[model samples]
Target: MPSKSPAQAALEKADKKANSSSGWFSSSSSKYEEAGDLYQQAANLFKMEKLFREAGDAHAREAECREKCQESNEAAQAWWNAAKAYKRGHPDLAIQALSQTITHLTKAGRFRQAADREKEIGQIYLQELNDLRKACESYERAGEWYAQEDAQATANACFKDAADLHADLEEYPQAIARYEQVADGSLSSALTKYSVKEYWLRACLCALAMGDPITAKRNLSKYSSLDTTFSSTREAKFINIITDAIEAGDMETLTAAVYEYDQVMKLDNWKTNILLKIKKGIQEEPTII
Candidate 1:
């Protein structure tokens, strides 16, 4: 028979306290509170032993106990600790823990923290799990929450992250929607209005990638109306040239335009990939007699 370690013994004691059969002597809330403390002790012991998974489990138990006691702030902190513990061993479980933390934070009216946690969740999904779909959802949620909190800068950044992921996934309509959204919001202030051109360019590129020349031309006109300076920018001219080349099925002109633009403003991998797709589409079209 193997002897129980200190953490294991502490967990057993926590379970017993949490499940006590006392009907009248002790209050349930008090029992849960005590159990939560014992669970915290167990978690600390597990962490000291470098048993990260066990520590995470113990912290999760503490969070459950805190929730039962109606201590939302404590529960949120406990869940955050659980997430950190799980992050040391299991990224997926860490994401789940962070989700619980976000829930509790939101319930406690700590939306800024919840929004920040949402971004963390998105990064984990995108970088660690390689799940762009989930990452996009998380970023979109974060953006919405940040926007509600009047943090437009952070909100736009989150939206841009989602838009980039949508573009990468070839979800052109969704990508265009987010890009235009950010561009529209950027119109309100001089500090951010300069960025509207890049956002509109990305949206225009997405429209072109969708083989919707009408929408691309319409968006170009809309952008020019929304920002009087847009018509004078290199981005607007590039979009116009690309739209024309695509309409004429002139691959050489399109390639040359992209090359010229890249010399001044380097296109990133995402834009380069989309341009390649657009080029492939042009090449695959049937030649006129």
Candidate 2:
């Protein structure tokens, strides 16, 4: 028979400790604390054995024990450790661990840490799992939390990621709404006000993609009225040119306008891809006799 490895021995000890009740003289909290310590020991031993998934499970058990003891901070830390251990081999499990971390952090009034973990969950869903919808949901949650914390820049960034994913998924209405929300939020801030034009431009692009030139044109006018200076900006002019070209079914003009704007400010992949979609829409419009 094969000898038990150190990790296996530690795990057995942890299981035995966790299953046993507190002595008659000791409190239940003491039992849970003892079990948590044993679980932590098992986790460390499993890490030494390079059994990451097992280590993650041990950490999760520790977190449960901590929760039973009403130790929110300790539970949050254990959940975070579980997430890190599960991240490389089990992305879905990592996300679950992160969700628990966020929960405990929130319970402990650690909103910023919870928001940060929410963003991490979004990245894992986006990059590791290719689950765009879940990623968007996670980002939106993070953005809301950051906004509540007055971290506007970080909030807007998360909102943009969610909006971009919405656009990629062809959920134009959602994309437009999020962009407009971010743009409106920025209008009152001197530092962020100048960036609102870009957000409005993206919203217009989403409207155009939905084959709603009227809405797109109206949005440009609305932004001008709201910002007062929007009408004179390069973004406003570009949107006008693109809207007119779409109305006239002039694909060349649309392409040239995007190229001109890109010369001033190089468009990123999200903008380039949306513009390509807009151009395709123009090409598909049937010419009236």
Candidate 3:
């Protein structure tokens, strides 16, 4: 028989404490703190043993116990620790732990840290889970915090990530709305002058992809309102071609115009693929002019 490892012994001790406390009926915060300490010890042992999933669970329990005792800082710390543990073995569990961390941080009025955690959560959803919608939601939350802080550059970046994810999901109206929001934020400060025109044009592309000439026209007008000479740019010309193709239900012409635009300035593979998907969607379900 193999000797019991240190981690196994610690787990047993922690389990004993938890089981014994079940009926102790102690309302003292110290009692909960003691149990939380035991759980944390067990979690550390589990991590040393490479039992990361169990470590995460143990740490989460520790966090819960701390939270029940009104230990906000300890609860947040435990949650973050749990997230780190779970990320090694279970991405979904990591995300859940991060969510708890964000909740605790926000409750503690740590808005900047919460926002940073939200962005990390978004990246995990996007890259690890391949869940674009949830990623978009996380990014939107982060953007709200950054906006509240008047960090417009970071806020617009988060919005762009959300918009890109929405576009990836083929939620054109939502993507356009996010892009428009980015453009609006950029126009709020002269610092983002370089990006405002491109953002508006992206919004126009999304509107064209929606096969909504009215929406496309509205975006063009909105751009003019933002910057009087925006229509003179090559991006605006390409957007005009796209809108015209959309209005005429001419996907071939749309493709040709996109090709021409790419010839002059190479388009990203992602944007090109999104355009293809949009064209296919329109061809499958043609809306009236």
What's the CA RMSD for each of the models? 2.3, 2.1, 3.5
* Model 2 residue 229 CA deviation in Å: 3.2
True lDDT of residue 131, candidate 2: 93
* Candidate 2, poorest ten consecutive residues by summed lDDT: 278-287
lDDT of each: 0.93, 0.91, 0.84
Question: Judged by TM-score relative to the true structure, which candidate is superior, 1 or 2?
Answer: 2
Give the best candidate by lDDT.
Answer: 1
Q: Candidate 2's residue-wise lDDT over 1-289, tens digit each?
A: 9999888888788788878877889998888898899899999998988899999999999999999999989999999999999996899999999999998889778888999999999999999999999999999999999999989889999998899999999999999999998998888989998889989999999999888999999989998899889999988899899899989888788889988999998999998999889888877887889
Candidate 1 wrong stretches, greater than 4 Å: 1-13, 19-25
TM-score, cand. 3: 0.83
lDDT of 3 by residue, 1-289 (tens): 9999776777677666655644566655766777789889989999888999989998998898798789999999999999999889588999999999988888888888898889989999988899888999999999999888777788889999998888778788888889888887777677887787777777777776676778888779778877887888888888888878777788789889988999997898667876776687678884656
Backbone clashes in model 2: 0
Q: Give the worst 10-residue stretch by lDDT in candidate 3.
A: 19-28
**TM-score for all predictions?**
0.89, 0.90, 0.83
Model 1 C-alpha lDDT per residue in residues 15-133, reported as the tens digit of each score:
99988875788888998999999999999999999999999999999999999999999999999999989988598999999999998888888888999989989998998899999
